[model samples]
Target: MRTLLIKNAKNIITMDKDRNAYPGGSLYAVDQQIVAIGNDIPYQAADTVIDATGKIVYPGLINTHHHLYQNLTRNIPFVQKTELFDWLITLYDIWRCLRPEDIYLSAKVGLGELLKSGCTTAADHFYCFPNGVSGELIDEEIRAAGELGIRFFPTRGSMSLGRSKGGLPPDEVCQTEGAIMRDSRRLIETYHDPGRFAMVRVGVAPCSPFSITADLLRESASLARSYGVRMHTHLAETKDEDAYCLERLGMRPLEFMEANGWVGPDVWYAHGIYFDDGEIGRLAHRGCGVAHCPCSNMKMGSGVMPIVKMLQAGVSVGLGVDGSASNDGSNMLGEVRAAHLLHNLMHGTTDIGAEDCLRVATMRSAKVLGWADDIGSLEIGKAADLFMIDSRQLAFAGALHNDATLPVLAGLSQTVDTTIVSGKVVVKEGRLVGVDEEKLARMAQAASNRLLNEASLRTKIDYGRMRANRAYPNF
Candidate 1:
């Protein structure tokens, strides 16, 4: 069938078993799987040939967690300084006004941004569903990702505990457990492709411990396991969440999750910032994974995760941009850089280096999502999912000693020159190949404006012009 070749790369940072790097490298692929990769690749010509002479190539970054719809709700003035509980409380009112068009357009904007930043695979956690809105909102997201050509893993996220039932979300956004379970199964049967080099996969994600009931958590895990898919949720994200679990369930957040069968390699939690040393050890022992969202945690005033300790204890820790609302953007490269800098500040400069951050974004992230066999590295028979950066750019002028580290340690210019997914170049010359970005931006802005105005008018809460004057402004 179709074949692709990348030739004369400045350096190919292959995160293989040996963590090899080849200068003046080349890679060849047939159909979607890589056939050869090294300094001396055998057959030369292909249908598509990318001359990567001045560029450094690396395994495409994988995003383990995100809330793509929240791209429309970023930078709201009132919720800028709030912590997890208050932040979710304020945003739930606005998120309850989400429309199907909003979901599609925002997924385009968020997923498009991730593609530009060299993210080839993305796992999005879209959990909010207003009572009267379409229950199949994840379909819109799946459609958007297909159009963009980014390998998508969209979790059927649900929230069953409304404020009326002692949950964080408003009553309007919660749903019945029966409805959530039925939709999740339908999505898996319709779209989940477990075969190698899969372009689309599905996961079961209940919103969070505070936003969903324990019964739903157990049921969601059981449902996902029955279908042999992964499970995701937010856990141990803040001190307030710990307090809530201790008071409401008489257990810590991790302990409660364990009691509900939510711990294992097939499951991953977002923003694991509040786990103790003992809890981190438990996660390691149980083979659980953590999606560490450094940017979102910092933006929400959530404390830093004990990532260094987790890694030392052999826990699978991956980096994610979290949600567009909290991260303010889906820039996976920036997330990698932030992870490197933040950990160095917390631990030492040597504890988590630039290449280590890249590994976390690539290989470790794939492991977190249970996709290590098919993705996460540039190896023979693996999917040729990778990105290229022009290492000769002015920002990387003198930092060419280590091409693997250039992405994390170098100054700006993090936007990639090209991004390939499944042996197809989805982004070329720093632009999306399948999208007209200007049109997408216009439609997204219109959808976002309609959503915010509708929510504001319905609730009489001024989201656009609200002032952040007090130390803690009341929503």
Candidate 2:
């Protein structure tokens, strides 16, 4: 087995159950698992040793929600200033033109950004498929993750309702409910590995409340249970979603999910900004998880999630950058920083601290993605997934002098110097190890242009019309 050693770190925030922070520590890894963690682990037997002096090491950030395909459409001027519904309507046509190359290029670009931001494990919810694409899209994403050496959970997301059926998505983008279920089963069987140090896993996601029928929700949950994977969906993301569920389904978004048997430890909801007090209690009691997307929520004008309340109520909550089109960036550090600032703004100054936000980004986020046992912390026998940030950078030049952990807490604006997933170094010196950055950026740009130029998408940009129609009888 190949052994690797990382020695002489300024500080290592384990984020383990003990919440240990080791000063001037070392870590040893044997083939994908951590063998030892403490001060001064010997490196004589290791094949490679990385000198991590003047750097901060932590459990790699976990991103629990993202539409990897959305990376290609970031910063589109027309949808930049729109709300969730209007933004979707404006971008749906563009998304409907996605091809296999678009999916691959976008996943590479997005996952590259995540790695640079110190994320090792990422969960992407890609629900849009057009032009007769099969599970090839998910396969491409998985391949990209494997190539980059990032631990990934790519949800088999599907949307079964179209505008013809009163759903938000256009008719061409929605699939038959049966096809969605079958593909979900196939994906799980092919890729859902429950073993430690799994490079790629699959989850069953039926898109969102407004875009899928109730029957599909119940069936998806049952199917996910059969395979023992996980379930995810969008819930209570906005007032419009709440109103839609209330008017059509005769219940709020959380109530509807509970009624449909979509609440449990093996499930998580994205956004969750509009949940009420009772809903929060329900989630806590049922052991549900939430992917808190502060940047996306702020960008799309979706209300702030009650993160402080959720954490206090025992709800498993983690950070997500969400879709790139909505967030306009895939920076996990920025997401944590936003979480820190937003929670403090929502609660008091002492309500949430930098460490707490960092916990959500690392350990809590891993728990939500069902990978806590193997990769969430720097512990013996756990997967060696972690990242290091150079404390000597301008962002942390003076911050590290006061406190060793202060740089991670306050230096959210910087990039990680090194990112390792499963004992393999995917990034060193703030660059990807497997792919060329310039080539990847150029391919992404070309793919984006090709998607945008599809003839079928030329007339799909009537944002005013969609916003005007947003008030149409709530369902």
Candidate 3:
């Protein structure tokens, strides 16, 4: 039985029931679970000791939504300024060129970025499968996460509606609904684990409303429930999606999802920007969760989510970095900062603050993913999943004026210096310990170029048509 001890931190934001902050506190872990947390614990010999005198410790950030594959296609020139539907349409051809190696390389690059930014738990929505790519794509991501030693929740995302069937994606990229369900079941049976300190888990994600059939949604939810895994999907991200569901399905997006068994405690939706008060109440009542992606929503002109309203109504909300292609970066710290700014902007200065944003990124995010009992907070008997930020940095030079209460405030004032997951140090001194960042960057760039140059995809992309087709299709 291995043990690790973290001693003499500047502060430890426990994020417990009382939201306590322990100054000059120490925590001890045996195996992968935290055994004790307080000012000073009785000495027991340990294999590892992290002296974090100048650092602040908190629960590792949890990312509730992301398209890790999209890291390969970030900041493409043509689609940089487009809205949600237009952006997806313009890049659909590019995403079709994603090979298994591309997925692996991008997952490494993206996960490395998240780890550097203090994110230890991440959920990746990898829906695109082209050229007969199997669930091996998800296996590659899981392999990367295991090598990095971070906790991962990879959703088996599927798209079953093509442009020929009035969907957003082309026929080559979309699969049959029956095949999607079968593969989803296969992925859950093979990957999902409910145990504490689990390294990898699976989620059922049926892409988005416009790219998948209603039948797929219902069936996927039923299958996920049968396997006791969680369900995720994109919902009401933009006004266009709102109009589409209202006109086509004779109900708003949330109402349509309810008709198809998509609402519950086990399901969470990404970029819930256009949900109304009634819909928010429905979500809160049913224990449904939302993965709030503030930067992506603002970048894509999807409007601000009523996050404050949702929280006030008792909805479970978490922070998401969304897709790197849309947000153009995978910095989880930046997502927390954006969440702070956007939520305050939407509700007013008094409603949402830095602590609220931090909670959304850590404990609240764990709740959204249904992993709160095991990994969200720094509690005895919980998994030792947390990160440290050096408060000595320039960002917090004058910010630690209130020494005892400073670390909680410094959460918004500094970047992560160390990221620990399951009692293992995955990042130390602000660098990834498990992989070479420079090499991963080079491989990611090469893969991005190859995706852009793929013949079948390059021939299908019509940049001129994308620019000319400005007519918003009637919902």
Model 1, which residues run further than 4 Å from truth? 472-475
Q: In model 2, what is the error at residue 192, expressed in angstroms?
A: 1.2
In the order shown, what is each candidate's alpha-carbon RMSD? 1.6, 3.6, 3.4
User: For this target, which candidate reaches the highest TM-score against the unseen true structure?
Assistant: 1
Residue 102 accuracy (lDDT) in model 1: 91
Candidate 3 local lDDT, residue 231 = 95
Model 3, span 358-463: residue lDDT tens:
8888889999999998887899999899988888887677787654234444555337788989998999888899577888898899888778767335676543
Pull out the clashing pairs in model 3. Answer: none
- What is the C-alpha lDDT profile of model 1 across 391-454, one tens digit per residue? 8788888877877888877855655999999999999989999688999899988887887898
lDDT of each: 0.90, 0.85, 0.85
lDDT score for candidate 1 against the true structure: 0.90
**TM-scores, one per candidate:** 0.98, 0.95, 0.94
Tens-digit lDDT track for model 2 on 357-461? 888888899899988888778999998999998878776655665342464466666658899988888999989996889998998998877766672347754
Question: How do the candidates rank by TM-score, highest first?
Answer: 1, 2, 3
Q: Roughly what TM-score does model 3 have, to 2 decimal places?
A: 0.94
What is the total number of backbone clashes in candidate 3?
0
